[model samples]
Target chain A: MLNVTEMLEEIKNSPYREIEICAPHTGRVNFAAIQQGSKVEGPHGLWKEKPGTLLCTLDRERNPKPIAAVEKGELCLLHSELEGCFVEAGTRLAVIRHLLTRDEVQAAILKKALHLFTAPERAKYYFVPEIDKKVRTSGSQSVTVKDGMELFIMSRMKREVPLVYTGPAGLIYAVYFTHTSNVDAEQPLIGVCPPDQLAAIQEVIMRVQTEWTEQG
Target chain B: MGKSNKESNVAPAGGLIDVSSHKVLVANRGEIAMRIMRACVKLGVAFTAIFTKEDTASGHVRLAKELGGEKNLYRVSSYHDANELMAVADDAECTAVHPGYGFFAEDFRFARRVSKRDRKLIFIGPSWKIIRELGDKINTKRLARSLNVPTVPGSDRPIYDEMEAERIARTVFDFQVQQGIKRPLVLVKASAGGGGMGIEEVYDIDNFRSVYRRIRNYAMRQFKDEGVLIEQRITDFNHLEVQIVSDRSGKNPVHFGTRNCSIQSTGLQKRLEVAPGFSPDEINYSFDARKVLDDIVHYSLTMARKVGYDNVGTWEWIVTHDGSPFLMEVNTRIQVENGVSARIASVKGEGGVDLLAEQIRIGLGEPLGYNQQDIAFNGVGIEYRLIAEDPDNRFTPWAGLIERFGWQEKPWLTMHTHVPTDVPYEIPTEFDPNLALAIVWGENIEQAKDRGRLFLDSLELKGCKKTGGELKSNVAFLRQKTAGILQF
Candidate 1:
């Protein structure tokens, strides 16, 4: 069902997500039961044979606690010196990488529109789908809109609010919201074509991320 | 006045422990980092630089590597991340850390962490205790008043309610009337704010509540501290500051003369010149120009000595049109315009003491070699902050790839910037407005002003195609101000 080239392209574009495990307090590391590149599922997996597991015990003077895996991923100990040495609170102990094999795309309404669409129960809006009647459709199931095209119209109290789609033009594969159902901010209103067609959306997200990074 | 070897081991209340043998870590970026690196090179001390991801190709990083080898360059996610900075310092085996202004320079927690015994690192500035005390405007004003330093009359305490603000405004107005002052104005300032940020002027009593609320919100958003203080705004005033350096030996602090930064637009400093701009024959208050200079130097030293402040710090004051001076705030770190003082002090045959190097020596538990009388001010020095912003667009900050850049070097002109010209370089849009600084010194203010204009005309900034327009500078605005045409 998935193209091999498209799958590889998705893997290349997806950013590597890593979760770091830190020391709870200033203390010595009692033991590290897992090795580098070990698969860790969860905390309970440390005691049993499970797919994802990571565990390390730190010996504080009053309390000895176990630090376990928070997500299912391969464990990579960042500091080997922590085995018998003291570490201050907030020191990184290990990092886990969540490897992905397939591509998945998600579309959501911008959370910034909450002030206009929500909060008032009497608020009402509709998505006036920008379907080109002139263009010949490949089939009845295919519904595609260009980037910056009007995806929907949101109105509150008889006043129309402008809303446009900012992602790459592609086929509308799925719709998550009903015709008259209430939509929450940032809710996945619809599912567009994944992989290559989401490039515009990705660019917008990167720009926003850059802005936030600069602010920090 | 230098410290003996026997007293070097003991750390005073606000003094730096001996760290001469230690490697220094500069936890900053840009021109300030390069300035610190230069100081380290002069002292023959090995130094490391921590740069953000955005600064990997920056000139400061390259300079650090060239000075102390490639191993000395460390990269972090951001300059404000204390954890990463400490980790890098520890990895590099740095014994002392110099936080160039803006990031962790005033962060007391960072200072505490650096000075902790377990960390085994020394902060090359005042102690965390002193920074915390002087950082709060209310506490600083109180301390100044206690030390017989004249401070602006305002709400003696922090005002949380509108009633208190109104009452303080009325009291200040009545006092101004009694003092026979005209056009009394009130200012609401953030207690923990600096750099002329979070300051609002109140012209009328009717809009006091709204202005106060707006200032509080701005302060809360900018500094995360909503605490506000009210003070009488000096309308026709000259912004002057004295740079002072102290050591742990409890000896007298040295004053590096005074700088007049009156050429400011919208509260942002545009140009700063030494020698105060006014001659002794021009205006006479209670004291002549010489007496005023002497009084300022004396007050600055006395305050530093009282607080046991070590290393370089600045005391800012507002000299009213009527010639009365009032303490405004204390900057506990080296300033961007410190080159003006350095240049002025370096004039004549007197050995010019590098303020950054002096900071390092003080951090090494070395007493100031010279006292107040030994220091002399000669010639006039002026500095212009070259910011990458469009003046035509209300000073909106701009960022783009600088395709071409060049500046002519002159004997009287000194430019401090980290523009990467060898390779393609783009200034990050998210940082401060300042791209570089053009500093010039001459035998007199006129020569200095001439050299400043020449220096500005020699520089150029070209943007890439994607940038849409040429990179902008405030040179024209600065020239107008220097020529005495532009006035507030």
Candidate 2:
């Protein structure tokens, strides 16, 4: 039921997302020396121990704090006018255009092909305690979720209520929300893969890994 | 000039200390910072405030901009950075620094740097020497024992020798047994280790040796110190603290009575505090609550006088269900529950006494102007820590946008908060999730509890997360606990 070639073709046509960097608080902004079209790398290395490229520094109360890029991208525009000037919080400092990598493209295609389990209500979502421990120690892909299984703890108004899964039994292929984050009602919380679709999912991954190329 | 100044205001024995020319840098954030700034204004002294990026929309920043006017508020990167605070102080030309409750409040190094730097700034607290001396737990115990003030019966020094350690343990057990304690517990822990590491509790005296040996060996391997401490584990005691205020000349010190802060979260964080420490007339306590309160106050003042404790501090104590009281430790900084004590306090014939104003007045090189006879206590005051947290889930902090937050204003209720009600505010995750401190007062304990319940019922706190889920608060929990306040 999934068309891998068509999904890859659709992503190849337009494979970029624009990200705007905003000031986290009121401060004097100073743009790190960067030119338009300059390449920037996001955080990398195992455990993300290495920081990404420095975009600028926000100086407040004689203390300078570094702001780094969150995604690998090309510098599109810099708000140089804000340099050396005091700016309020939420001020847009820069715009970056990032090219979608093979991993991201694979993720985009998989989201469409997999059976997505959605949140029933707009609340903070977390895996139930026992499943949470398992998911944390192992990966989400190793955990199988089934219909009527208590899979989540929906937290709202300081109270926690258990949420039961209602989809086909399958491995949790993707997790859309972290324990600290909130999810909207009817939004996908996890993408599940049925037992028979394992071959198709593996084929999609194999094709993307072998055929997809990174754009310069 | 001395004669005229003495006639104008009650000057100390020396003369009136003119601190009108001084400016203070409030080195903190949120409620305490706002309190300090307001105190500075009341004392006719200029003050500067600092806030990090996330706290830009905090009520303190708005208050600073309104009252302090232009160039008085600085945006800081972090509240924990001393260099940033000092640099701001210098840039703002502030004459002194006020380390409110946290951050640099208890750090002697920061206090020392504030005084010892080339361009010195007065640290609005005890001198660095006093802070250093009392900051050490062992030193504080030794000081208390030296003055014959009652401390928890334990070995004050590290027990390096097995024989001496066993002797101290035997004495602790025998003392507990004499006190009619059932199944006495002994705590053995590595002296150099902290945060519950290298610690064990022995319920049976026969198990003490094995636990001690294990902890000592672990301490030697992990902390590189074979030293261990042996003490009787105390539990089921009500927590109490005495508020001590003095001038730079620690000679004439006074107390603002005591407060009961035993109702705490599972993590030992205080949630509710009641003034006067105990309610003997209203609630029939197992002990002589009135005498216990007086004893703690007396012992606390004694230690304050002995150590020349100059500035605002708290002497923490714990009273067993029986009448025995034990000095726990000293917080050499102004505490969060200071307002509850102030609420029940009055000066001379005037009912409204501002202890923060008093602290700033004396902290900025001024005299106390009054003594014990001028101070008096009236009424029962209860302070509820209104926070966005789950009471059923170990008080886990809830973070989200507070769309609406307010309560009915009453004559007896004093609310202190940094959350802005006029605008939708996002709770900052870096700090405590405390929304406000609502202190309600009454003529007696029953009325105070009644008003506390009424206040909680009147409170309107509504919010939501990024997910459309509603905000969670301890308002109901607070309402339910209102009846049991200050009870044994």
Best by TM-score, which number? 2
After the best TM-score superposition of candidate 2, give how far the Cα of residue A11 lies from its true spot, in angstroms: 4.4
Off by over 4 Å in 1: A1-104, A108-216, B1-20, B157-183, B275-287, B464-467, B485-488
User: On residues B243-264, what C-alpha lDDT tens digit does candidate 1 reach at each position?
Assistant: 8888756466777778877876
Residue-level lDDT tens digits of model 2 in B65-173:
9889868988765777787777778778999999998778888999999999888999999889889888766789999889888888788877888888888888899
DockQ of candidate 2 compared with the true complex: 0.10
DockQ of model 1 vs. true complex: 0.05
- Model 1 Cα interface RMS deviation (Å): 14.2
- C-alpha TM-scores of all predictions: 0.71, 0.75
What is the alpha-carbon lDDT of model 2 when measured against the actual structure? 0.83
Q: Alpha-carbon error at A152 in model 2, in Å? A: 12
Clash pairs, candidate 2, are none
**Model 1 RMSD vs true structure:** 11.4
Interface RMSD for candidate 2 relative to the native interface: 8.1
